[model samples]
Each structure stands twice: as C-alpha cells, then as structure tokens.
Target chain A: MIALYRVLVLVGLIGLWWLISLQVGGVIIPSPPATLGAAQMLLAEGRLLPALGDSLITFLGGYGLAIIVAIPFGLLMGAFAPVGKTLEVYVFALAATPRVAFVPLIIVFLGLGVEAKIFIVFLGAIMPILINTYAGVLATDRDLLEMAQSVRAGRVETFRRIVLPGAVPFIIAGLRLGATIGLINTVVAELYTAVRGLGGLLALYGNTFRMAEYFVIVLMLACIGVLVAEGLRLAEKRLVRWKSGS
Target chain B: MTEPAAHVVLSGVSKHFGHRDGTPMAALTGVDLTIATGEFVAILGPSGCGKTTLLRLLDGLLQPDTGSICVGGAPPRPGPETGLVFQSFRLIPWANVRDNIDFALTSSGLSLSERAEKVDEAIALVGLQRFASAYPGELSGGMKQRVALARALASEPQLLLMDEPFASLDAQSRELMQTELMALWARRRPTVVFVTHSVEEAILLADRVVLMAPRPGRVIESLPVDLPRPRWGYDVHGHPSFIALRRHLSERLRELVLTDPGSDFFQRGAPRS
Candidate 1:
C-alpha cells in the first residue's frame, strides 16, 4: 500500500513538472522526456559515468576520513571529562561557523584540486559525526556501567563490551547526517575548486541554459542521495536488531 | 541445622553522601550485621532507609565512611566470589541472554568452554534455556529479571546480593520468582543478602529479617524467621507462626512510618508555624 502511494506521488510530481514546463517553456524547466533524453545522451557520450566516478571519489574520500577520525576523537572526548570539557566549546564554535567561510583558506593551502574538495567535504561532514558519537558515549546507561563495575570488568573491557555497543545507534545516526551533508559538500567543493565532477557538469549545462541536462545532473544527485540513505538505513537495522525486540 | 560459619561481617559501618549544597547526609550510620554462610537474609525498610546503600557497601560498590566490612574473611571487593542482582535488571540490551550471563563470568579466570558451561547452567537454573538467544529487549519484565538472576549466578559467586530484585514485577511474578529463588538457593546455598521494602516478601524468602529505620539509617531490629524450609510447599502465609510474626513486624513497621519525619503522615499531621 505504501509503495503504491509512493508511485502515485512520483507520477503526480512528474505531471506537475510537465505542466509547468508547458507553461514556462523548456528553457527554464525541461519536460520529463527531455530530461530522460539528456540523460541518455550524456550516457552515450560516456561523460556521465566519468563525472559520477569523480564525485564518488571525492565523496567517499571525505566521508571515510571523517568516520575514521571523528569516531575515535569523539570517544576520547566522551570517555574523559577533562578532554570533553576542554574541547567541547571549540568544537561547537567550529561547527557553528559556516563551511563556505573555509573555502578561501582551503583553496589557498590545497589549490584548485581534489585535495581542496576533499577537505571542504571533510569539514562539512565531521562535526555531526563527532558530536553525536560523543553524546552516545555519554548517554550510556549508568546502571549498565554499575553492572560492569560490579562484575570487576576492567576499564577497557567495559568500554569494549558496554559503552561502544551502546553508542552504535548514535554513531549510525551521525553517519546518516554526515552522509547527506558530505554529499552536498562534494558538489560545493567541485563547483568552488576544480570543476571536474557532476557539480562541474551542472555548472556547464546550467550556464549554457541546457535545462534538460541540468535536470539530469540534479536527478542523478537525488538518486545518489536516495541510495546512500537507503544503504545506511539497512545497516542501522542490522546493527540494532535488539532494539526491535522479537 | 548446624550453625554455619560467619561469611559476612560489618562492624560499625557508616556511609554518608553529600547534598547539592555539600552538607553531608547520613545514608547508613553505625551499621553492624553478620550473616552465616549459606544464609538467606533480607534487609527490610521504607524508602530512604538506606537498605540499598547497605547492599552496595556489601557488594563493594561503595565504601563506608567509617568502620570496616569483611566477606569470606577478606575485605569486600567485587570479584567472581561476589554477585549483585540490581532491581533494574541491568542486562545488556545489545546482548543475548547467554552473552549477558557470559559477561559476568568473563573476569572469573575461566576458559571459553568453562564460561560457556557456566552460562548454560545459569540459563537452565532460571528455566530460561529456551530463551537463551533472546535479547533483554525481547523479554518481559519477569524474563529480564530472570536474565539478571542468571547473570549473577553464572559467576558462581559465594555472596549473592539482590537489591529489590522482584519489586518491579507484578504480584504473581514476584511470588513465582520468590519460590524460584528459594529453589535456586537450596541448590547453590550462596550467602544471600536481599533488600526490599515489602514485609511479606522479606518473611517469605529470608531466614532472618533485619529491619532498618530512616533519618540516619540504622538497624533497629533483627527478627529470625523460624518458618521451615521449602516453605512454599505449604500455605506459609496462613500458618500460625507466620501470622504472629507478620502482625508484630507490620505493627513495628507502621510505627516507624508514623514517626518518620519524612513520611506523609508526619507531614500532614504537623502543626503549622
């Protein structure tokens, strides 16, 4: 029933898009068929795959590095009161600052290349993952910790068995948030620095008033967003099976 | 039964906590108690009476501000020889029943096979063998408590400390758990110190009941339950001895409540300034 509703919604959205295209002309808003034709042309020309590959490289590089660095850093902040208290203010300050503000500095240091793009994506994605992981560790049940202490579990053992597992849900939530932001940053990095990926294609088509190809790029991004979100959701379900009970 | 050797001793033990303003609040003051090996003793008191505090002290989770404690001739410290069952169950929500029980045995210096065996035995002991693979979230309140019990038992602790283990359960489950606890006690014969606010529960499960009073919590009376073992096999509550003891204890408890400064009875009856 839900799937049927989703299909209906998609069709309704397409119909609306077509009606708007008819009224405004295809220059501003391309019809659905025109966008499809543009997608096919891009694929036939072999430009779409290479551009997608470049974007994937930038996205994965930045997001993967963020996960590796942020989780452990967050764990340390949470596990030790001194570390958490000392760094939390600075982290919050950095997170509050706009990612676009760092673009000039990042480009100056790294130049107009993939490295600059990766840095921008990392800056955009890191805070949510770090903050959520830290919160997760802090939110571990007091009773569970007491239970661990009662059993004479050592500090490392308790962390491994109880604290880390307890923090899984929070970490996954962070990952999901980070992923969406990271993808956005990927496009931003491409457009702002080296114009070599899907963001570059979007700039080219949009500037030339090729609305159909511009729509294709936008739809490709939407598809990628859907796929990443769905993948994370499945991973979360597997990791937190106990949360759903029987 | 022959007199068993003293397995636990607390002499002049006192514990204090600080209020938000930093004033020291007396949780347990000048408490002295002893328990014979393989004895089932219940500490009964109203809320704020520090029964739970005393149990924590015994479990080595907290240290007394004054005096000393001994368990099995050594200073009390949490180890394989000491098992604690919390009222909240405290079973790991991410772990299955078998793994939760296995967690308790991890620090026991047991090999993998031995720990697995102990876990299996504890699961069977609680009659939760069928649900060994189930997570705590999948279990009902009663089943969760059973998992907690099994976790405590898996370590084969010589001293078992339970803090209101079944107080959260429905009445029927509480009664059923009480019987099962007795059966487990008979089989393992651990020196058990159970804490609860319920008078009937104390009388039902314990061989001795230590009554405590609040406002600087301390033991006021220790009554021996002379009721025979396997007490559940008969109508223990309706027995003449049970009736007499219950009446005396209930009256004493009522008097404590009525006189307690923190109780609503005193709060409502007090003259306004």
Candidate 2:
C-alpha cells in the first residue's frame, strides 16, 4: 500500500515536471520523457555504465573505509571513558567544521587521482558515522550493562551480545546518512577536477548544453541515493527484527 | 531449624559515593551481615537506605570502602556461581526470551547442549515457555520481569541477589510474583538476598527481614518471620502474628523517618507502607 502511494507520488511529480517543461519550451530544462530518452542513449553508448561503475567503486571504497574505521574507533571511545574524554573534543571539532573546506587541501596533497576523490568522500562521510556510532555506544542501556556485569559476562561477550546489537539502529542510520553524503562528495570531487565518473559526465553534458543528458545523470544519482538508503533500511529491518512486531 | 551453612558473610562493609562538592556521601556504613545457604533474607529500607548498595556489594558490582565480603568462602566478585536480578527487568531488547536467559550462561563454560537445556529449564521455571521467542519490548511488565528472573536463574547460581525485583509490577502482578517467588524459593532455596522497601513484601517472602535505617545507611533491626513454608497463595494477612509484625515494622520504619530532620516535614502526611 505504501509502495503504491509512493509510486503515485513519483508519477504525479513527473507529470507536473513534464507540464512545466512543455510550458517553458526550453532546452535548459528537459521534459521527463526527453530525459529518459537521453538516459537510454547514454546506456546504448556504454557511457552511463562505466561512469556508474567508477562512481560505485569510489563510493564503496570511501564509505566502507569510513564505516570500518569510525565504528570501532567510536566504540572504543564510548566503551572506555578516558579514550572518549580525550578524543571527544577533536571529534566534535572535526564534525563541526565544514567538510568541503578540506577538499582543496586533500586534492592538493593527494593529487587529482582516485585517492584524492576517495579522501574527499571519506572526509564527507566519516563524521556522521563517527558521531552516530559514538552516541550509539554511549547511549547503551546502563541497566543492560549492569545485567551483563552482574552475570559476569566477559568483555568479548558483552561487546558482541550487548554493545554491537544495541548500537545497530544508530549505526544503520549513520550508514544511510553516510551513503548520501558520500555520493555528494563523489560529485564534488569529480566536478572539482573534471576527472571521471557520473559527476564528470554531469559537468561534461552541462558544459556542452546537453541539458537532457545532464538531467539524466542527475536522475541516476537520485536513483542511486534512493537505492543505497533503501538498502540500509532493509538491512536494518532484518538486523533489528526483534525491535518490531512479527 | 537446622543450622544451614553460612554462604555469605560481610564484615564491616562500607561504601561512599563522592558528591560534587567534595563531601563524601556514605551509602552503606559498616554493614556486617551473614546469610546462610537456602536462606531468603530481605534487606528492607526506604529510598536513601542503601539496600541496593548492600546487594551490589554482595554481587561484587561495587567494592566496599572499608571491609570485606565473602560468598561461598571466597571474596565477592561477579562469577558464574552467583546471579543478580535487577529491579528494572534488564532483558536485552534485541534478544528473545530464550536468548536473554542464555546470555547469563555465556561465561558458564557449558557446552551448547547443556546451555540449551538449562535455558529451557529456566524458561519453564518462570512459566515463560509460551513467550520463549518473544522479545522484551513485546512482553508485558510482568512477563518481562519473569524473563529477568529466568535469566538470573538459568545459570543455577548457588547465591541469588535480587534488587527489588517486583517493585515495578502492578499490585496484582506484584502479588502474583510474590506467590510465584515463594513457590520457586521453596523448590531450590538458593542463599537469596532480596532488597526492597515494602514491609509486607519482605515479611511475605523472606525468612528474616533485615531493616536498614537511612542517613548513612546501617542495619538497625533484624526480625524473623515465622511464616510457614510454601507460603504462596497462603493467607499471609490472616496469619496469627501478621498484623502485629506488620504494624510494628511499619511504626519502626516510620519512626526512623520521623527522627531524621531531613525527612521530618516531607514524611508528615506521607502515605504509610
């Protein structure tokens, strides 16, 4: 039922956009059908697939790395009070500052390569993952910890059974946010240097006045965002099955 | 009564929590007590009375500031031989009833089959077999506490420490749990230490109610309850000495508040136990 309503809303939005495009009668903003046509052409020419592949590779590298590093580090800071106190200020400082401010320095140091792009994505995505994970670990139910302690559950058992599962909802929320931010950073990285990926195509088409193709790339990016978020939501539902009714 | 073996001994145990302004607040002071095997003792006191602190001392969750505690001839520390049930049913929200019970068995060094057997047995013991796969969030308050009870009992500890286990339940459920607890205790009879503020509850469920006075908590009185065995669903209110003992303890607890300057004004017109 919800899916049907969602599809209806999307169709209504496209219909409105199509009507506006027809009324404007300009190449600047293409109609939905024209954008779809450009998407097909890009796919037929094999350009869309490769750019998508590149974007996915960069996105996965940065996002996966951020998750791997930030979660455990955050857990460490949260589980141990001394570590949390020492690192919390710096983490907040980094989270507070604009991530884009570091892009120039990252590109300058790492050069206009995949490494720089990955670094930019990492900088964009890492803070949400780190902060949310920290909050999740910090917010672990004290009563549950007391229960575990009273039962003499060792460190490993406590972490595995209590902390990890307790932090799942927060971690999944972080991953969803990270996915979106990572995509945005991927575009910023590519647009900055005009090097590769769908962001490069976006810039290439926009520069040449191929408005429909540019819109298609933007549409694909939106689709990718939706897919990543939907994926995380599905995984969360599976992992946190006990949190919901059967 | 036969002289049972002394399973827990506390000698001059004291615990102090640091206040923000630097003055230390004594939670428990020079608390010396002995609990014998198969004995159910209730530490009854008001809010500030450190009944919880005493229980935590025995559970080894907190170190005594100035003394020693021994359970089963060893210094107290959380181990497989002891189990603790918190007032708040601390069942893991992410785990089902069976898994919550099995969690207590994690460090027990038992094989998977043995753990499963124990977990199932405990689930049955608590009458939670129907909700064996239910999560804490899905269960009622009473069922959740039952799961907590099952979790603590799954390890088959020689000593069981319960910190106001039924305080959160509704009156009806609390009464039911009291009866169930009595039945369960009648079966295995572990060296149990139950901490609560309810005078009647203490008498209903314990062999002896150790009353602690607040304001630097210390045991001021210990009264033996001559209630019979298998007291579940028994007319505790109709017992020969029930009203007399209840009224006496009630007055004594009230007197403690009345004498204390801090509790004087507030305790006036306050509800009685």
Candidate 3:
C-alpha cells in the first residue's frame, strides 16, 4: 500500500507537469520528454561526457586541495586556543560570503581558465569543511585526552589513538557537505569560463535560448552531487559501526 | 622515556579547585602518603572528598599546590608507569578492545610481538578474550569496565590508578569484577590506588582502605584489610570479617559526609554499603 501511494504521488507530479506543458504548448513550457530528448541529442553530439569529465577533474582537484589544507589547519585551530582565536572569525566571515560573488574578481585575477575555475570551487568548498572539522576536534572528550596523558602517551600516539578517532564522524560530515558544494561550485565556476563543464554548457545553451537542454544538464549535476553525498554518508556509517558496537 | 622503575610517593600533597567563576575552592588539604611497590590501597570517600584529586596527584595529572609528587625514583616522568582506569571507561570509540589495551603498552619497551602477546594475556586475565575485537560502545557496562581494567593492566604499569572503576556496574557484575581483579592482582601485583565511595568495595579489595572526609578532602581513617588471596569473591560478600570492616569504614565515611552535607555534590547519590 505504501509503495502504491509512493507511485501515485510520483505519477501525480509527472502528470501535472505533462498536463501543464501539453496544455500550454511544449515550446513555452518544455515538457520533460523534450528536455530529455534534447539532452540525448547533446550527448549524441559527443560533447557532454568529456565536458562533464573535465569538470569533475577540476572539481575533485579543487575539493581535494581545500580538504588537505583545511584538515591540518582545522585540527590546529581546534586544539590550540590562540590559533583558533586568530583564524576562526576571519575564516567564518570568508565562508559566510557567497562564492558566486567572487567569480568576477577571481576571473580578473586568474583569467578565464581552469585555474580560475578551480580557485572558485576551492573558495566555495573549504570553509564549511574547515569549520565543522574544527568543531569536531574541539569537542573531543577531555577525559579521554587526560587518559592519554595519564598513560604518558607520546604526543603522536595520543593523536593517532584518541584525537583522530574522536574527530572522524565530524570530519566525515564536513567532507560530505563539502563534496556537494564543490560540485555546485564547479558548475558555477564554469558558468563564465570557456571550460566545457555542465556549467559552460548551461551558458552556451542559454545564449542559444535552448533552456530545455540547460535544464537536463542541471538535473545531471544535481544527481552527481546527491550520489557523492550519499557515498560519504555510507562511509561514515561504516566507520561509526565500530563505535556503536561497544 | 625513562626506565619503567617502580616508586610512587605523595609527600604532603594538597590540591584546591576554584569556584566556577575562579574564587578559591579548596579540594585537598596538606596530606601525606606513600604507596610502595605492589601495595593495593583504596582511597574510600564520598563524592567531592578530594579522593580523586589525591589520585590525580599520584598520577601526575594535577599538581599539589603545597607538596611534591614523585613517581618511579623521580618526579612523574612522561612515560608509561601510571595507567589509569576512569569511571566512564573512556575507551577510544574507533579502536577495538584489543587496541584500547594495547594503547597503554605502545610506549612501553615491548616489541610488537610482545605487545600482541600481552594484549591477549590481559584480555584473558579480564575474561574479555572473546570480545577482543569489539569496540567499547558495543560492550555492556560491566564489560566496558573490564576492558578498561584490561587496558590498564596490559601495560604492566608499576602503578595502577582506578577512579571508582566498578561503581557504575550492577551488583552481580561488580562482584564478578572484584573477583577478577583479585585474581589478576595476585598474579601481577601493581601498586594500585583505587578511589571509591563504596566502603564494601574498598574493604573487599584493598590491602588498606584510606577513608577520606568530605569538604576540602582530608584523610580521616586508614583501615587495613589483610585478607589473603585466592579470596573467593562470592564467599567474601557479607563475610563476618568483611561485614565488620564494612561497618567500620561506613561509619567513618558517614561521619565525614554528614559534617558538611551542605556541599550539595554528595547529596543525591549512592550510599556507602
């Protein structure tokens, strides 16, 4: 019964969409089928896949760089009061600003190339991950830390045994959120550049007034973001399974 | 990394905690104690009685304001001579029980193979051999405490400090753990300072139970329990001698607690048996 209800709900949405498009004319409303067909035609032209592939490379590289830098800094900030105080307010302020606002500025500085796009993606993705990871490390149990000290555990071993394990779930949460944002930022980065990612395609489709094809690319990018986020969540679940067992 | 020598001395040790807003809050007064190698001493007191502070002083986690603390022929060295078991178990959430035990042994001068062997031995000693791979979160309350014990014991510390390790467990589990601790202590006699409010646990386990009084914690009574091992844990329960010792210790603890029940920390909690 629940499955039937789910089917009916989904059908109702699609039926409404189709009704609106057919009644108002596909030229104006652009039915889902027309968008899908346009997407297929764009793929047949053999451009979408490579463009997406290039976009992902930039997305991942930028995201990876941000994470690598953010992780150690975040950990340092959390563990040390002076460092956190010095960096936290400024970091949050920077993160709070929308990355889209920086595109024109970034383009002027780095030019309309992969570097600029990657920089934009990095700007978008780093702060939340950095902030949340800091919070995670900061919230680690002081008792457990004292336990490490009571044993006279060397500083390195203390980090390995206690600090890293304690901060993992939080780090994973930050990373999952960052991955989706990184993808979105990648598209936003490409929206102005000559780079052939989905964002660039959206721009090209827009110039030609082909909004249906643009809509298809947007859906595809949204799917990628969801898949990436879901993957991280699964990994977090597996990692924390041991914690729950005890 | 000093040699794992064996000495723990608290000479005229005292500690004070300020208020939440940083006014003076004395936690310990001038107190002197010496725990020799292989001595099992229990610091029995009601809550906020500076028993934990004394233990921490011995462990070098806190400094005594008025006195000096020395461990292993010198002042507390940054190495593995003092292994502590907290009430909360405080196990690393990611590591399994085996890793938790092995953590204390990491800085010890044991080879990898030796560490592995000792980890297994400790698990067996605590009767947690079957759950070696299990994480702390998976274990029952009793089992978590046992794992805590195993972790402390695996390092083969000359001094072991426990802050009411069994206070959280049920009657059956606590008794079972008491028996397990005795058997293990008999075999690997580390000098132990176990802090607890339970007069029964102190009497049942300590070579000497140091009864502490409440506000600005001070040692009031030091009663000896020289019950020889292989002491049967079940038979020891309500034994005439154990009961007599429990009564003596409880009377002292009650007096200390009632002196200033105004502290509000020890108001609503476990009664000393």
Candidate 4:
C-alpha cells in the first residue's frame, strides 16, 4: 500500500513536470520522457556512469577521511576538557562558516584537481562528524561511568566497552549527515573548475543549455543522496538494535 | 551463627566537597563504623545524610577528606575485592545480562572458561537464566535491578556496596527483592553495606541499621535487628517485636525530621533556623 502511494506520488510529480514543460515549451524545461531519454543516451554514451565513478571517488576519500579523523579527535576533545577548550573555538568556526566560500580558496591552494574537490568535501563533512562524535562521547551516562569506576575497570577496557559503544549512535548519525553534505560539496567543488565528476558534467550540460541532460544529472544526484542516507539508516538500525529494545 | 570478624572499619571518616573556595561542605563527618565479615548492614537516613557518600567510601570510589577507612585490613581501594550496585541499576545498555555480570570478573585474571561459568552462575543466582542475552533496556525495572545485583555478585567480592538498590522498584517488587536479597545474603554472606531511605527496607534486610543525621552527616544511632533467620517477608512484618521496633524507629525518624534544623525538607512543621 505504501509502495502504491509512492508510485502514485511519482506519477503525479511527472504529470506536473509534463504540464509545466508543455506550458513553458522544451527550451527551458523538458518533459519527463525527454529527460528519461536523455538519461538513457547519457548512459549508452558512457557519459553519466564515469562521471558518477569520479564523483564517488572524491566523495569516499573526503568523507572517509573525515570519519577517520573526526571521530577520534572528537572523542579526545569530549573526554578531556583541556583538549575540548583548546580546539572548540576552531571547530565551531569551521562548522559555522559557509563551506561554499572555501571553493575558491581550495582551488588556489590545491589547484583544480581531485585534491581540491576532496578538500572541499572534507571541510563540508568534517564538522558534523566531529560535533556529533564529541556530543556522543560527552553524553556517556554518568551512572555507567560510575559503574565502571566501581567495578575497577581498566582505562582501556572502560573506553572500549563503555565509552566507544556508548558513542556509536552519535557517531553513526554524524557519518550519515556528513556523507550527505560531503556529496554536495563534491559536486560544488567539481562545478567550480575541476574537469571531472557529476558536478563538472552538470556545469557543461548547464552551460550549453542541454535542459534534459541537466535535469537527468540533477535527478541522479538526488538519487545518490537518498540512497546513501537510507543505507546509513539501515546500518544504524542493525548495529544498535538494542536501542529500540529489539 | 559464626564469630564476627572486622571485615571493614571506618574511623573518624570525614568527607567534604566544594572546598575549592574556602568554606567546604561536609558531606560526612566523624563517621565511625565497623562491619563484621558476612554481616549485612544498612545505612539509613534522610536525603543529605550522606548515606550514598558513605557507601561510596566503602567501595573506594571516593576518598575521605579526613580520617581512614579500611576494608580487609587494607586502605580502601577499588578492586575485585569489592563490588557495587547503584540505585539506577547501571548495567551497560549495549551488553546483555550475562555480559553485564561478566564485566565484574574481567580483571579477576580468570580464564575464558572460568569467567563464562561465573557469569552463568551469577545469572542463575538472580533467576535471570532465561534472559541471559537480554540487554538492560529490554528488562523491566525489577529485572534490571536483579542484573545489577547479579553483576555485583559475579566477582564473588568479599564486600558488596549497594546504594538504595531497590529504591526505584514498585512496592511489591521491592518486598520480593528484599526477600530475595535475604536469601542471597544467607547463601554467600558477603560483608554488605546497603544505603537506603526506607525504614521498613532497612529493618527487612540489614542485620544492623545505622541511622545518620544530616548537616555534616554523622552516625546518630545503631540498632541491631535480633530478628530470627528465615524471616519470611509477610509474616515478619506482623511479628510483635517487628511491630515494636518499626514503631519506635519510625517515630524516632519522624521526630528527627521534624525537629532537626538540618532537615530542611521538613522545616514546614519545625521551628525555622
């Protein structure tokens, strides 16, 4: 029944798009069928998939590195007040700053390459991961820590069993949020100057006013975002099944 | 049943907090207590009487500002020799019942096989055998507290410190746990220090109940419950001596709360400072 509603919604959206395209004419807006045909052409010509591959490489590198660095760093900051106090200002500043502003700076520093694209994505992704992990670590239940202390649990054991596991939910939440923003940054980074990826393709097709192709690429980006977010959600539910009393 | 041995001793034990500025807040002061081996003692008092603090001191989770506490002929320190059960039943949400109990035995240098056996035994002892793999979140309030008790017992500690372990349970579960605790104590006989606010609970469990006063908390009275062993919960509550003791203690507790200046919570019925 839910699937049927979703299919109906899709049909409704396509009908609306078709109506708009007819009224506006195909110059600025293309019909849903035109976009689908364009998507198939792009797929057959090996244009879309390779761009997707390129985008994914940068996204994974930046997002993965962010996760690796941010989680441990956040843990330290959250666990120790001295570290948190020292680095808190910088983390907040980066997190608050509009990351699109860094595109030009990244290009200047790293040049127009995969490195620049990855750096921008990292900047976009790192803060959410860091903040969430920090919050998670700090949110370790006081009673749990007291229990650990009373039991004479060693420092390593306490961290491994208590601290890390306690923070898993928060870390996963951060990763999901980071992956989404990281993907956005990847496209933005590519759009600026880098010669490959979906963002670069979007820019080329956009400049030439290939409305059907542009719409197709945008649809692909949206699909990728939803897929990645859904994947993380499923993994989180599996890993922390006890959280919901399952 | 056996000759009493000094398993725990606290002399002039004074603890203060918030001393960073100048005037420190004394949580406990001049507390002197001695617990014999295999004794079950409960420290009973109102809020701010430092009962929990006293229990923590016994567990070596906190140190006194002045004076000394010794457990098993040594200065108090956290180790496998002592186990603690918190009021909230702080089992790790991520760990199952068996694992939560096994946690207490982690540093005992026991082999995997031995540790597993101890874990299973503790679970069975708590009658949580069927829910060995259930997480704390999955268990009811009564069951969670049982897991906490099991975890504390798993290490086979010489001393067990509990801070109002059953205070959160419903009245029925509380009474059931009281009987179960009596049964468990009869079996293992660990030197136990339980802190609680309930008069009936203190009378029900402890061999001796130590009453504490607030405002620089100190031991005010110590009474021995010469109640017979195998004291059934429902019947014992109606016993003549039980009635006399309960009446006296309950009246004394009410008078203390009403008259004592430190008992700010009951100041409405008392002369104001």
After superposition, which runs of candidate 2 have C-alpha atoms over 4 Å from their true positions? B264-267, B270-273
Q: What TM-score does chain A of model 3 get?
A: 0.86
* Residue-level error in angstroms, candidate 4, position A18: 3.3
| Top-DockQ structure, candidate number | 1
Q: Candidate 3, overall lDDT?
A: 0.82
- Interface RMSD, per-candidate values to 1 decimal: 1.2, 1.7, 1.8, 1.4
lDDT of 3 by residue, A106-215 (tens): 88999988898888888777887899889988888998888888777888888777887788888998898788789888988887666568888878877777867877
Worst 10 residues of 3 chain A by lDDT: A237-246
Instruction: Judging by DockQ, tell me the better candidate of 2 and 3.
Output: 2
What digit string (tens of lDDT, one per residue) describes model 4 on residues A49-119? 99999999899989988988999899999888899989989999989999998778788899998888888
Write down the lDDT of every candidate, Cα atoms only: 0.92, 0.88, 0.82, 0.89
Q: What overall lDDT, based on C-alpha atoms, would model 2 receive against the true structure? A: 0.88
Q: Candidate 2 residues A1-246, lDDT tens each?
A: 999999999999999988989998749789988988998999999999999998888888888889899889888888888999899999999989988898778877998888888888988899899889988988888888888998889989998999988998998888888888999999988877547999999889999999999999998899899899888989998999997853
RMSD of each: 2.3, 2.5, 4.3, 2.6
Q: Give the TM-score (vs. native) of candidate 4.
A: 0.94
Off by over 4 Å in 4: A1-5, B1-3, B19-22, B262-267, B270-273
> After best superposition, candidate 3 residue A24: deviation in angstroms?
4.9
lDDT (Cα, tens digit) per residue for candidate 1, span A136-204:
999999999999999998889899989999999999999999999999999999999989899999999
Among the candidates, what TM-score does chain A have in each? 0.96, 0.95, 0.86, 0.92
Which candidate, 2 or 3, has the higher lDDT? Answer: 2
